[model samples]
Target: MVQQRSVTYVNNTTPLSITTKELDLENCVNDNQVAIKIHSAALNPVDSVISHAANKWLVGSSLKTVGMDYAGVLVKRGKNVDPKFQIGDKVNGFISHAFGDQGSYSDYLIIDPSKQSAIGHMNNFDYLDDDVKARFSDFDINASYPLVFGTAYDGLFSNGQLLNSRSRILVNGASTAVSQCLIQIAKKHLNVETVVGICNSKSFEYNKKAGFDHLIAYDESNCLEKVQSIIKDKFNGQKFDLIFDSVGTSEFFPIIDTILKPRAEGSLYTTVAGSNKLKYTGGLKEYVSVLPLWNYAASWNPRRHYNYTYTMVWPKPAIMELASLMVSKKQFIPPLDSVYPFEEFQTAMDKLNTNQAKGKIILEINKDY
Candidate 1:
């Protein structure tokens, strides 16, 4: 048994312990998977939850691994794989749910090329090799879309029910990784007349600079009431067309209901820590709908079948292509708060636990490709 150093839970209650572990490469579905020389990995709350609550909801089968989003270089490709990706190509993408095959924290990480959502598309062909350049660019085109774009991209267009020229939107947690992109895309792509951001008063300056029409700090006395007071007439004399919530705390919901017109469509997208909870009232439970944003991203068209309305959230190829263009154009900046050296991974996790960081935390892997 070959051992690889990895961070794993000693038990559900304990903090992750770093230890030498067997490389269960054989557990992967196929042999053609390529190993990524991980240069960096982003720390998400999901990782911590899985470490502690491994049994409650996140069942660890053969599929338990640390890290989800990674930026790295292709070190080696397995057999039967196309020769498009040679060694040393810069890449970034998400690791799938199958943990044994998708772990990205190890020195060498493996991924199926066919399954990657975002990868760097490099053009390193000689001028003479036009056909080769085109072919390589086409085949190895790891579309360089950032992970931060995922929640915003999916939430806005899919769940938020946005079209190119829809009504203005108010994003509650505008400084979040997801909310930043939401503002960018709404400002750039959509003809939004207004983009109000409700967040900490300290973040008011930043959100104002980022193009928010109004920046209200929720902690301020009667902040929600203030919003209502200011926008009451515009909202309908009593309503708004849409309200996007990245903060799902119970407190935010009444404000959401207040802002929305009685029959108007509104969506609330939450990227905050922890799972979503549905609230119900007496005898009205049947009509209430509580949804996860991912569900809309996967299945654009909600369908009613066999006693339930099911919508599958998916990464559409077209939306990803749009994200690629947005990246190359630099229309939006992804929120990368801080990068931690591999040895200081625990420290990075600590910072994220504070929830005070403005953006995403990244862990840089030590090895050079």
Candidate 2:
């Protein structure tokens, strides 16, 4: 048994609390699991949503932790585990807590091999690309990349399939961490030619650096009109072949038909963020009502030939491999906004709640590690 400090859920409406607890290593660590001494963890919007509305979406237990991404050292490994993973390897990955009650908000986390894990070992620092290695030498920045990059890769390439070089793509919520990665992957990996990003003026500089061909600021009242006008002029009235919406507001639902290619084959709209209402509201009734509303709106227009899909990232080995390769090749740079100490958990949550972070926010769990 080992005693460590961890953050645990108090209730649905209250914030998470930190406390000392005893973990039975013998029970938690199995033959197919890897035992890690977590050093840092990153925050995501999904953590806030789940913490606020756990009663409706989460099942199994009342007490839970509230994070998904972690970076740590592999202190122990199971005998049956892969020999490639040795002790003291520097690693980072994400653990989805959608179905389970446990999460990564602790000093120690047990990663099961069966789950959709995105674990990556970074001990071979000498093998890293010179440019990437020059920019980062610690775990804090590496901790922030897994979830955001994995989500973006899955949404753009795996599910959306924007493979054609001539495809014109539009990315909404371009200021988001995931969107930043999507823009780079679309340009570098898919060899996409025309890529436009919709974001506020504050994010214009960052989006430009991320390799967006065109940018539309959506902070003003006539933002939609401006977007339409940009499409008319820049694209010569040709609609987008693919629209990726990281912002799931109802506003875009009405204008989707106007911007999307009419009756074009392989045209698609994919969103990682579900309905805005479902993300904020609590209780079963509110959850039930939001689903039908989306269904009705999506099916209302017959002329909208493009298919609509709501996607959740399922981390796989291929996605992680792609991300790792990009990082090693100096093609992808992980954007890390801020790093907070583990004791200031509430402050970290407050920053994420604002939803204005330019990149990922991380928590340094064991500074001395």
* Candidate number of the best TM-score: 2
Q: Which stretches of candidate 1 lie over 4 Å from their true place?
A: 1-4, 21-32, 56-63, 79-84, 98-101, 116-145, 233-239, 255-257, 261-320, 367-369
Instruction: Provide the lDDT at 336 for model 2.
Output: 66
Q: Clash pairs of candidate 1?
A: 119-142, 235-239, 297-314, 298-312, 298-313, 298-314, 299-312
For candidate 2, give the lDDT: 0.75
Prediction 2 TM-score vs. true:
0.88
lDDT tens readout by residue for model 2, 261-356: 764567777777755535432544444544435544764577656677766777676666887787777677777678788899889888887778
In candidate 1, where is summed lDDT lowest over 10 consecutive residues? 304-313
Q: Give a tens-digit lDDT track for model 1, residues 92-180.
A: 66554522434556555776666664444332223324553343232122221244566566656654464445465667677776677
Number of clashing pairs, model 1?
7
- The TM-score of predicted model 1 comes to 0.72
Q: Where is the poorest 10-residue window by lDDT in model 2?
A: 277-286
Off by over 4 Å in 2: 56-62, 99-101, 123-137, 277-293, 296-304
